[model samples]
Every structure is written in C-alpha cells, then in structure tokens.
Target: MIKSEIKKLPGSQIEISVSVSWDEWEKYIELAAKDYSKEIKIQGFRAGKAPRDMVEKKVGTGALMDAAAQRVVQGTYPKVVTEQKIDAIGKPQAEIVKLAEGNDLEYKVVTSVIPEAKLKPWKKEIAKVNKEYEKKTAEVTKEEVEKEIEEIAKSRVQHVDVEREAQDGDNVILDFEVKKDGVPIENGTSKNHPMILGRGVFIPGFEEQVVGMKAGEIKDFELTFPKDYHAKNLAGIACLFTVTLNKVQERKTPDVSDEFARSLGKFKDLEDMRKNVTEGMEEEKKHELKEKRRGALIDALVENLEVEIPHVLVHEELHKMIGEFEMQLQGMNITFEQYLIQIKKTVDEIEKEWEPQAIKRVKAALALEELAKEQEIEIPAEEVEAEMNKALAQYKQIKDIEKNIDLARLYNYVKGMMQNEKVLEMMENVK
Candidate 1:
C-alpha cells in the first residue's frame, strides 16, 4: 500500500509526498539485491549465485535500499497520478527523503499540471471575423490565359545560330580570362562557355562589354567586384577580363495554336488547353483565398482570447519548433551547428528569441482547445482509428519507427488535429 500527501503550489505545480509500505520496499530491495549480485563475483559462488544475505552484505544495505526506493517510486508514480488526477505537463522532479531498510521509504515529487484556459467570447469574435471577411470571386481573364499560353510556348522555344553581332537577350558563346594586377586569376578562364548577354552571370561590365561584339571579336575591359561580394579575396577589387564572342544565337518561340497545344500533350485543341489552365488558376486562387481567410480567423480568435500560458507548454512548443527547424536544416544538408553559426546566435540565444512566438503559439492553441471543448466538438472514433491506421501505415515503411513510436500518443495527436480542424471549419462557416 502507498500513502501520499498532495500540496498545490503556484503556477499549477503540485508536490506529492509518498510513503511506501515495508513489505513493498522489501520486495524491491530483494530485486535490487539480485541485480547487484549480477555485477560482482563472491567467494565460493559464481556471479549472481550469491545468497541474498551475502549480496546484501557485499553491496552496502544502504545502497540496496536506495535502489529499492527508486524502483518503488518508479512503479508507484502512475498509480498516484491516476488516483490524484495530476494532468501533469512535464516530467516530475523526484527526491528521496527516506530510504532506510526497515522504515517505509518516502519521496517527494514536484511537477507542473496543464493550466486551465481562461478565454473571452471566441464564438462571437469568430462570427464577426467571418462576416467581415468578404470572399472575392476569382475569374481568369482571356489575357491572363493567353499570357500563360505564351509562357508555355516560351518553354518550347528553340535557339538558332545567328551571324549577327551579340545583342542583349542573345545567347553568346565566349572565351574569357580575368586578370588582377596583370596576373591571371585562377578559375577565371573558360573557353566556349555559353551565356545570355545581360544575364549578369559574369562580373558587372563583363557581359555589357560583350554586347555588339561579332563572332571572333575580342576585347579587354576592367570590372570592379561588388563591395559586399561573398568572397573576401575579390570583394571591392578591380579586375581586367579579356573576352571573345565566338557565336551569337537567336531565340525562336513556338507559335501558340491548336496544333501547338495538341503537340504539348493530352489536349484536343487550344480551347481545351485554355479551359484547363483557367480551371487550374481558379482552383489555385480559391485555395489561396481560403488560406488567407483561415489565417485571419485564427488571428482574430487569438486576439479576442486571453490566458496565462504556462512556461512548460511554451518550452514544449519552442522545442517542437526547433525540431522542425532542425529538420529543415537537415534537408538542406546543413548541420544545426552550422546553421547557428550562419545565423550568428547561440542555442540559448535562439531560444530566447523564439520565446515570445512560442508563448503566442501556446496561448492560441489553448484558446482553440478551450473553444472546442465549449462547443462540445467530438471526433468520431472511426475517424480517429482511420487516421491512426493511416499514420501507422506510413510509419511501417520506415524501419525502426515502429519501435520508437507510441501508437496511443500518435492516436491522441491525430484526434486532436482532427478536432482542431473541425473547430476551425465551424468557425469558418460562421455567419
């Protein structure tokens, strides 16, 4: 049997002082002795074969009793939480107060609970926002559709060799070498490199100097690197480039017509292509509008509500955001440390910077959750099961995820996401 004294503290914290019965402590002590016996050899006995008395004597009874107390605390904490309804937000801080062999083991656990939500009239605010937001009807104009068709035609453009002088928008093949202080700079020479004039691929003044140069024409000019250039060695320095325009190429765009549309694929004619593009554009506009309104609705809802968000929740959100940022960095093949260096911030500094945003996110989430509860929004079990199964199925493809993931927690997360979406939809439809 276990007994506990629970004390409420400021900031939704609770302190639970628990005492375990002698019999229970003894059981864990015996188990601890068995574990200790596995580690060391005793005279006239193989490893782990030592008698309980011998093991207790070998490893001090105090150490064994302390281990037993920890075991009891670990095993009994859930029962305490269930009986007391802790609604704990994070891990508890546990300290053993008494661990003597014959006396009942006692420990105290301090932990934070989920804070209660105190909010304003969210429904009225949402309704007002919904009414104020006027949905714009998106219409695709003929000129816009024709512009899209012209873009498609440009994609199919062909380049043809031309004997004329190089001009802006003309593709030029050239040989060039850059020199600083009359010495050829390494990695500054190329032959037959193709570049479009005025594209700004080369140093400033290099391509403009190529303009009006015919095939086999060569010229020399000086160009200054940008003051804020990425390379410190060349930044704010002047260099000379010897250039030659080997050839000039002219671009020829395909004609926009029914034949061209059919050639692109799957389109019966030009009208069919235009109709498809219009439909796509309309759908894109509608999705953009919906997203805009959704953001506005959430902003309005958050503005109307007020709550004292707990630090634990904010910390959790901050960590989650950091994890997402880390994933993005990983996708870019950059290490988190490298990103920190680029951003010129320490991990602690980054967290401090994100604290305000984290607090806002937590408050908004709690407000939405409270609104959901007040509106009695419930997610169907079948829908939750379906989402869970779908998520688990995705996990099945990734090796070792099954071992790491907790299905119960994932189910709750999916259910919560569904509930939030449902509530948002309800708010969106408000008149």
Candidate 2:
C-alpha cells in the first residue's frame, strides 16, 4: 500500500510527502537487483546468470535499496499527484526523508502550482489609450505622394547612347584599376563596369573626376580612404585609380501622363494613380495606428496584472525568445554563436539581459488568459479548423511537414490564437 500527505505552502507552492509500505519497498528492491544483475559480472557465471543471493551479496543491499527507492519515487509520484489533484506547473523537486531496509520508503516533493490570476480593470485603461489615439492624426503629405510618383518614373528610365561628354546623372561604362604605392591592389580591377555619376557608387572623388570626360577618354586620379574603412589595411591610405571611359549613356524618363499610367496597368490616368497611392498610404497609416494601439493595450494589461507568475514560465519564455532571435540570425546567414562573438557577450549574459522582458511577456500572457476566461470569450470549432487549415497551407512549402502534422496540437494553437485576437478586439472596442 502507498500513502501521501499534502500541504499548501506560501507563494502558490505545494509540498507532498509520499510513503511506501515495507512490502512494496522489498518488491522494488528485488526488481532493481534483477535489473542491476544484467550489467554485473560474477565468477563462474555469465552476465545476468548470477544467483539472486550472490548478486545481492556482490552489489550490497544498501545500493540495491537506493536504486529501488529511486524507481519507487518515479513510479509513485504521478499516482499521488492525480489522487491529490495538485495542479503542478514545472518539474517537482524531490528530497528523500527515509529509505532503509525495514522502514517505509518516504520522500517529499516541492513543486509550483498554477496560481489563480487576478487582473485589475484593464478595459478602463485600454479605453484611456484608445481615446488618446483617437485625438491624434496620421496624415500622408503631398510631397510624400509626389516622391513616390517620381520614384516610379525613375524606375522606368532607359539608358540611351549619347555623343556628348560625360555629365552628372549619366551612366558611364568604364575599365578601372586601383594601385597603392604603384603596386596593383588585390580585387581592385574591373573591365566595362557601369557606374552612374553623382551616385557615389565609387569612392569619393573617383566618379567626380570622370565627369566631363568624353568617350574613349582615360583619366587618372588619387583619393584617400576613410579612417573608419572596413578594411584596416586601406583605411586612411591614398590610392591611385586609372580609368577608361568606354561610353556615356543618358537616362530617358517617360512623361508623367495618362499613357504612362495606362502602361502601369489598372490605372486610368495620372489622377487615378495618385488617388490609389493616397488611399494605399492612408491604409498603411491606419495599420500603423492600429499597431500602436495594440501595443498600448498590452502595456496597460501587463501593468494591471496582480499575480505571482511562475519562475519556470518566465524561464521558458526567455528560451523561446532566444530561439526566435537565433532564427532571425539564421535568416540573415549568421549563426547565433557568431553573433555572440561579435557582440562580446556570453549566453548567460544575454539571458540575464532578456529576463525582465521575459517576465513582462509571461505576465501579459497570463493576464490575457484570465481576462478571456472572465469575459467568457470562446472560439468556434469551425473558426479553429479554418485557422488550422490556413496555417497548414502556409507551411505546405516545407517538404515533409504537411504529411506529419500534429492535428490536435495545431488545433489547440489555432484556438489559442483566435481567442487572443478576440480579446484584443474587445479591448479595442472599450470606449
């Protein structure tokens, strides 16, 4: 028979004491000895073929009981938790209280429990933020719209052959070589390279000297690299560049008229294009404003939460955020280890730096979940299915993920997302 005693501790913690009868302990000891026999050697006997009495004599009853007690704890913990109905959060910490040949095997487990979340009047705070946002205006200026139009026109420009001398804003094709102290530098020679003057595509003063040079003209110039140039050897050093201007091409831009707008497709005229651009800009501004409002609401919600968040929850969130950061680094063709070296920090230091933010994020999540529960917010089955399908479609590009999808876990994730969205919508409507 097994027995347990449960006690509630301060700060949403619980202590459970579990005791196993002597008969039960003896049974586990025999089982553990049998398991240990498989790896023990005895003279004149094959492995695992030693007599039980000889095996006990070889490994000692104390060592055998110790291993048996470990197994007993592992096997009995779940039954105690389910019988006692303890909502444990993270892993349970165990300490042996009594383990001997004849005494009942006893151990104590200390664990964190999920605390009941208490939230303040977050809706009122959200309303205050929303009212402030309503009074502020986001507008797109006329110059901004005109700049977009100009960029579109510039993108459509064509390079044409010209007989005049090279000028600023003209595309020049040239062959060039750079030398330092009359020694040819590595990776400093190119043939028929196309450069646009006044674009600063070359080193400062390099392209400026090319201006006014006609076709088939060769010119030589010297310029000093910046003190903070990326290559340490060339920093602040003067280098000579020999250039040959093969040809000059002038940019021919299309007229900003109805014909040009029609060529862009879907626009009837310049006015129509301008109208659509203005509308698009307005929509973008609205999205920015919405994001700002959402941020404000989350901040307010985090401030209103009054609960003791589990340390394990915050630690898990920190690790998750770090994983996300690593993924972003990978996307940029960089490794997390490389990033750590470049930033001159250890992983522990990075985790310490992110601790406060992780705590805030965990608190915000708990508060949202509590608020949703209090408000009786529920997601429909059809909506969850649709969201799961949409997510599956997005990830269908991965070769094997679609075939091995975890439908239950995906549905739960989608349901959680839908509930969060509904909660945010409620906060947005608080007036």
Candidate 3:
C-alpha cells in the first residue's frame, strides 16, 4: 500500500509527500539488484545471470537502496499525480525524505500546475474594437503612391562614371576606416563601399566631408557619433575617418512613362503600373491595419484577464525571447556576446528588462486560451495534421527531416495556433 499527502503552494505550485510500504520497497530493491547484476561483477556468475543475493552483496546495501528509492519515486510520482488529478506543468522536482534497506520509502515532489484564469468580459470589448476598425479604411494617398513610384524609378537609376568632385545626388565609391583614439575600431573598415551623397546614410559630418572629394582623393576627417547611437560603446564618441574616394558617378533616374513601364516587362503602360502600385499599397496598408486591430484585440483581452502566471512559464518565455533576439543579432552578422558587449549589459540584466514583456505575453496567451475555452473552440486533428505537413514540407529539403524536427511538439504548436486563430476570428466576427 502507498500513503500520500498533498499541499497547495503559492505561485501555482503543489507539493506531494508519498510513502511506499516496505513490501513495495522490497520489490523495487529486488528489481534494482537484478538491474545492477548486469553491471556489477560477481565471481563465478555470468553478467545479469547472478543470483539476487550475490548481486546485492556485490553492489552493497546502500547502492541497492538508492537505486530502489529512485525506481520507487519514478514509478509512484506519476500515479500520485494522476490519481490526485493534478494538472502539472513543466517537470516535478523530487526529493527523497527517507530511504533505507528493508524499510519504507518516502519522498516529496513539487511541481507547478496550471493557474486559474478569471477573464473579464472581453467579447464586447473585441466587438467594439472590430467596429472601430470597420469604420476606418486603409486608404493610400496619391502622395504615397507617388513616393513609391519615385522609389521604383530610383531603383532603376543609371550610374555613369564622371571625372568630377563628388556632389549631392551623386553615387560615390570609397574606401574608409574609422579609428577612435588612434586605435582602429572593429567592423569600422570597408573597401569600395558605394553611397550616394546627401543621403545622410553616414555619420553627420562624414558625408559632408566626402562631398568635395574627387576620384583618387584621400581625405582624413573627424566626426562625433550621435549621442543616441545604437552601439552604446561608440555613442557620443569622436572618431577619425580616413576615406579614399575611388569613383564618382552621376545618377540618372528614369522618367515614369510608358517606356519605363514596358521595360519592367509586366505592366502594359504607365497607368497599369500605377494601378498595380496603388493596389499593392492598399493591400499593404490593409495588412498593417489588420495587424493593429489584432494587437488591439489582444491588448484588450489581456487588460481584462486576471491570472497568477507561473514563474516557470515566464522563464520559458524569457528564454524564447532571448533565442529570437540571438537570431536577430545573427542576421545582423553580430554575435550575441558581441551584442552584449556593445550594449554594455549582461544576459541577466537583459532578461530582467524583458521580464515585464514576458509576463505580458504569458497573460495574453492565457487570455486567448480562456477565450477559446469560453467559446468551446477546438482545432480539428486533420487541420493540425495538414498544417504540420505544410510546415514539414518547408523543411523537406533538409536531410533527416524526421530527426531534426520534433513532430509531437510541432503538432501541438500548430494546434495551438489554429485554436488561437479560431478564437480570434470568432471574437472578430462577434455581432
């Protein structure tokens, strides 16, 4: 027989004390001894074929008792949780309280459980937001269309080498290196980099210094980084730059006309091109507006949600956010360690700063889950499978797709996504 006691702890955690009878302990001891026989050497006996007495004598009473306690705890914790109807999250932390040869086993297990989410009235809030969004139109102004057209024309601009000093609106190719206090800065050297003058793409004074330089001209100047520069180490610091102008090219932007449209190989005329651009801008604006509305909906839901979020969930979310941040840094060709050095902050400090956001994200997810439950929204298995298959297809070109992907985890993620979508759609379409 097994005896147990359960206590609810703060922060959505539960503690369970379980005691197993001596008979049960003895059974596990025998099993443990049998397991040890395969690994423990005994004279005149084949591996795993030694008798229990010899196995126990060889492995010692203490080792056998420890192994038995482990087995007993592992075999009993799940049964206790299931019998008690505990909705545990993450892993249970186990601690042995009592273990001895020929005696009962006792252990304590602490685990986090799902918290109760008491949600406020959110349907009306979502309906109001949806109504507000419905009243607003995603309209693209003529100026916006013209601006996009100008950008397209600029993309097709021709650059012709000219033997003249670099000027505003002229493309300049240059080699440059920046140094602070006579020491070269990392990632501050470039060769044959091309930039158009008057773009303000470089430092405040750097572009002006290049404006008068002709091809083959080497000029040295000093500039101060902006006080609010993204790299904290270089912010508000003076740096010396040595720039060698290699080439100057005058830029000629094409006129937006029927000929330009024909050259694009898709539009029939300038009017057709304008129409497509306008439509594209409109679609983009609509998407932006839709995203804003979705954000507002989630914000409203989170505002009305009341739940004690588990620290474990927030910790998990923080690590997920960190992973995403690391990926973004990688995209910029910066290592995470280098980013930390540039920002002058430790990972712990960064995570502390992101804690509130992590908590908010957790609350928002809980709110969505509550809404789904209230609405009885469920994602079909077939839909989850289809989405999983679609996701898998994207990575099918990679070798060993099955080994690389956790299919069970991917399925759960897809199902959660589908469920959230269904719930959000219901809220959006609430009459």
Highest-lDDT candidate: 3
The runs of at least 3 residues in candidate 1 whose Cα sits more than 4 Å from the true structure, single-residue gaps closed, are 139-260, 269-271, 325-350, 390-405
Stretches of candidate 2 exceeding 4 Å from the true structure: 8-12, 23-26, 42-52, 136-139, 148-269, 380-386, 393-408
**lDDT score, candidate 1, position 281:** 87
lDDT of all predictions? 0.84, 0.86, 0.89
Ranking, TM-score, top scorer first: 3, 1, 2
Q: List the residue pairs that clash in candidate 2.
A: none
Return the TM-score for candidate 1, rounded to 2 decimals. 0.73
lDDT of 3 by residue, 390-419 (tens): 877887474589787888998988999999
The sequence of per-residue lDDT tens digits that candidate 2 reaches over residues 306-369 is 8887787777888899999999999999999988865768999999999999988887788888
Q: How close is every model to the real structure, measured as TM-score?
A: 0.73, 0.71, 0.81
Top candidate (TM-score) = 3
Considering lDDT, where higher is better, how would the candidates rank from best to worst? 3, 2, 1
